[model samples]
Target: MSTTAPRQATTPTSTGWSLGDIAVRRVDEIELPRQTGPWLLPDATKEVLDEASWLRPDFADADVPRLASHGFAVTAGGLRIVVDTGIGNGKTRANPAWHGLDTDFLARLAAAGFPPESVDLVITTHLHTDHVGWNTRLAGEDWVPTFSDARYLTSRTEWDHWAAADLDEARRQMFRDSVHPVRDAGQYDRVDVPEQGREVAPGVFLVPAPGHTPGQVAVELRGSDRRALITGDSIHHPVQLSHPHVHSCVDLDPAQAVRTRARLLDTLADTDTLLLGTHFPRPTAGTVRRENGRYRLLAEHGSEIAATAA
Candidate 1:
């Protein structure tokens, strides 16, 4: 048995893994406040989390599941892609933790060798506030596309759903600042993602993963030797692997979310596919294993950059 202790949290740096020809890095934004777990995943009570002993200290701090907001920068087939931009710096968000903050996200991205200007594509797994916040940044008086040279890609179904929904003031503000700017600049490209999935770039495909939102899709990366799936919000934490039915508080369709998660886990279990979670904390990437008829992650640690002064 491997007796490896969970990796401790350190200052955000250029941490990543290499999948044959594909190189992926986790660019740190900010670790969410401790309150996020209970609020976002109310069903994952302390008792439930305690059951997954492996989750302690790393993925979860005792009973509270630990989560961080970050982006995965991928270099594949000569394309520099960013998967799900985290909450951007200086944004007015309804959630207090996400509102009007400052972080060195861009600098971290550059450290990972993915500067904004050099980014070829921005893959938005869904149109949620957090996922798209970095889609644009405040430029003088107006929000502008952060990745000036990149094309923003998201599922056509995701864009259409938000287009028709009666959004709250905060959500509208998110769209106005983060989403619309990219579209207005002709940088947003909506792709039709069928049930089987759609390839947006070489070795990069968008797999249908709905229910958290109407058209949430998981990004799939296939390398010469390994395949990895980026779970947008479908699997918020490793605890969910132990409790597949545990649903998010904001899931648009909780039942469908469960179905989606179950199917995804079933397919991933005992397979070599690496699961890179969008919100997972340190040691963010892992492999899914069947445990007692449920699932659990066997974390895959990658190379890390030394923590620098903030």
Candidate 2:
């Protein structure tokens, strides 16, 4: 794979990108400025952000930095796979902003032409509150699988970790509502990928990218000539592209997170593999490049092609 020239920075709409035969689309749930607390990233100080000037306007403002929580709808191998469901509606949440959300998430998905039932599989990169909230929905007095016909795929390590974790009530409540219901419905599949990568679907694979969560994995898509990696919280913001060592506060293992981030950035730098950040603001997809002996992201417009040959 080869590198591509940077394209003019364009605003990221709810548009999708085509990777040869596969189509990847973004199903937006929420996009807001990054919370002004160390709860997200303690190292993301104004001084640190000031150095990454590219993050302004779209990612970080003078007052508030932006972060997005959305899901990707991957259509490949004749399958409709929904990766990482965002926070669902009408559920109790510890965070005030996430509680009782009434957004038209399902409506937006349908508007994007992907109804819940039409989804063949739902892959949770990790079992986090925001990532797995849409796995179930409030139905009458109990929660039920939102994608009634889709099979749920979660890493075995993630499943076991949450299952046996000594979590607080709030986190336990999240599992009871979002994950348990799917497991009870017999639709949940525990994927035990012992190696770094494993083919989960035709031309699509799961690459182990742990640290954000014990079992966090990045979804890789290989089309006829192009490839893309859906980075699931491995690198939350573009700022990490410049400073891979600055880990998020929520990272389960800070040191390991740093290692994972550095490895991924080094491996993909100056390569054709498109990097699709799960929490990055507008123009969320890009390719890594080395500049001034450091790494940066060359943001890509959906229609832009790789400048170099594979």
- Taken over the whole model, the C-alpha lDDT of each candidate is 0.88, 0.80
lDDT string for model 2 (96-198, tens) is 6677777677776765667788888999999999899999998899999999999999889988888888999889889899999999999999998766688
TM-score for each predicted model, relative to the true structure? 0.94, 0.91
Indicate which candidate wins on lDDT: 1
Lowest lDDT sum, 10 consecutive residues, model 1, at 1-10
TM-score, cand. 2 vs. native: 0.91
Model 1, 1-310: lDDT tens per residue?
A: 1122222235647888777888788988877777788878888888998888989778888668888899999888889999999888789887877777677888888877777899999999999988998898888999999999999999999999999999999999999999999999999999999999998888999999999998999999999889999999999989999998988988999999999999999999999999999999888989999988779999998887433212
The residue pairs that clash in candidate 1, if any, are: none
Cα lDDT, model 1, residue 154 = 93
Stretches of candidate 1 off by over 4 Å are 1-12, 305-310
Show where candidate 2 strays beyond 4 Å: 1-14, 36-38, 303-310
| Model 2 global lDDT (CA atoms, 0 to 1) | 0.80
